[model samples]
Target: MPTLRRTLGLLAIPALALATALPATATAATAAHADTASSRTVLPDAAAAGWLARQLVDGDHFESVFNGTAYPDQGLTIDAVLAFAASRSSDEAAAKATAWLAKPEILSGYLGDGTTEAYAGATAKLLLAVEVRGANPASFGGVDLPSRLRSLQTTEGRFSDRSQWGDYSNAFGQSLALIALHRTPGDAPTAAVDFLANSQCADGGFPLSFGQPTCAGDPDATALAVQALAATGRTAKANTGLDWLAAHQNADGGFAAAGATTSNANTTGLATQALLSGGRFGTGLKGWSRLVKFQQGCSADPAVRGAVAYDATGFNAASGTRATAQAVLGLAGTPLSTLSAAGARPDSPTLACPAPATR
Candidate 1:
């Protein structure tokens, strides 16, 4: 028997295989299968965790959703690590992931990229991930991840990055920064709360960027802003944003991004967590229902079990890992700030696997 490190559950959807790993075109069976009413509804946590668990490459790491290979994809690995720990489905994988992250090579590239220099979003996310698993961000992997995050903060309390993807470095990264710094309140920027509150649009939602002459509400950014505001006991503000979100829920029980034409599991999952954080589950349940249907189950091909498509359009590897992983958070009803241990880590079931085919 394999020497078990700790309890672990992961899933690998065949629909999630890297684009290069498959033929030039998606097969009809894989592309045409959509979640219908008759589809068996599995626990969102179980379905997503099972899928996340199977994707572990070695005893310690998750395969990249982008390449379907076992490389040092620490940036993406953090999502699965936090998801498994939050769902109580895989402690071993979480622990092993923590161990793997302690290595220097995997983290070196994440230090920065593009014009913004430091990968500010990556650093903030890692801080949140380490904290989620009960690990110390201050000393994880030789460098203090939390300290690194704070160093990136501006005096204005805005955690902005002006890089190639700098446009994406606003509310999303700022939200994570606020949550991570909350773990160490003293060190967190005092102006952080106000920064987020100021980002809110007249519609009671927040935009993905700051300094916009006008407020344009983004579903994803609004959701995260709600959670971040709630952390500071700003229920009045949080509720305002939540109300905007409530009004925007698509009849299908899901939400789209600020300007997107279609609703997606990824946005729904994110909004779900934010609503739960603000104590607004009543408005979020329909979306939750829509969210769960995205996961593949026994009725689907065995290889695709536990997979979650981004939306009804069907599953695509491009969005599978991120969409499913985020869905698990909503399915479990645990927000990013509340993902500490509820069930013991040892209580999770195991998924059998072959030895790592490659490092």
Candidate 2:
């Protein structure tokens, strides 16, 4: 068994993987109608978290059913757990989801079967998630996740996957590794920090894939890197990454992926949290507004109301789960590295749009 490090319920979402727009001058009429349509007793964050909790399979986890086969979606489930923690709502649902992730059968598949292969990113992400839930990662499912992740570190300090197939770890995995290690009693190795810092593209953003012929900065990767480096006391490095992200923000205050001009909730959500962590308050608030625009209000089906859409096309069952899970972080103004579920509500609340006033 490895040395157990217990972080107090400060859970975070992994690199699950966003839009833009103004309400005042650009579209005053649309803004007023949106406000009236979204009149709710519950806060948007709480309502969004509530809708997310209700989507869990068995009120605990999510399933990726493919061709009639139901496979446990531990990654997506962890995203929900972190989102619940960030919003400080749906404590019961978060706890249940966390518990489900700790099951030996479920844990094995996600972190790998232990004997055959181990996923560096999944291990790091799970470590971070369980710690946020206030659980002991060392003792989770009878495996030491932190220790397991440590074993996968490369000579270059990047955490690589251990598999017969190939090494699939990337910048996202490296960021998660640094973050999870930072929360523990031990500091992330200096070598690991150096490796991450050295990987920054000339554009000041981090790339989704490492060692490409040419470095291409990705918004999602850059956001996670900012949070990780900042959490580890690398403020200057983190700020440079933030600068890159800021440079890429759309006119509507949301972000788009690299080479894509359209803003979406998933990227914007991650970037919003990074902005807050990096002290870019004005930009972060703008990101929040963009995320709000992606949310489905009461006019949509009740089941999907409060759920965020991926882009302007509106919410669909396939993409809504991932979109909402990521968006809640921004909607709640909760940064991933410091998210906690303490003092959260046990129940998920519904959006209550008041009846339209008759003219």
Model 1 shows how many backbone clashes? 13
Best by lDDT: 2
Residues forming the 10-long window of minimal summed lDDT in candidate 1: 1-10
lDDT scores for all predictions? 0.69, 0.81
For model 2, the superposed segments whose C-alpha errors exceed 4 Å read 1-33, 36-38, 355-359
Residue-level lDDT tens digits of model 1 in 1-359: 00111111111232234323545486644443332222333334655776776766776675553455445667667877777865667776677777887787776666553235666678888888888877777787777777677767778787765456443578888888887788775645768788888778887988888888888999988888887778766778889999999999888778887788688877988897777656675766666666756766545565666667887777787678788778877666666766664353543332222234686
Q: Per-residue error at 67 for model 2, in Å?
A: 3.6
Candidate 2 clashes: the total is 10
* Model 2 quality (TM-score): 0.89
lDDT computed for candidate 2: 0.81
Leading candidate by TM-score: 2
Worst 10 residues of 2 by lDDT: 1-10
Native-structure RMSD, model 1: 9.3
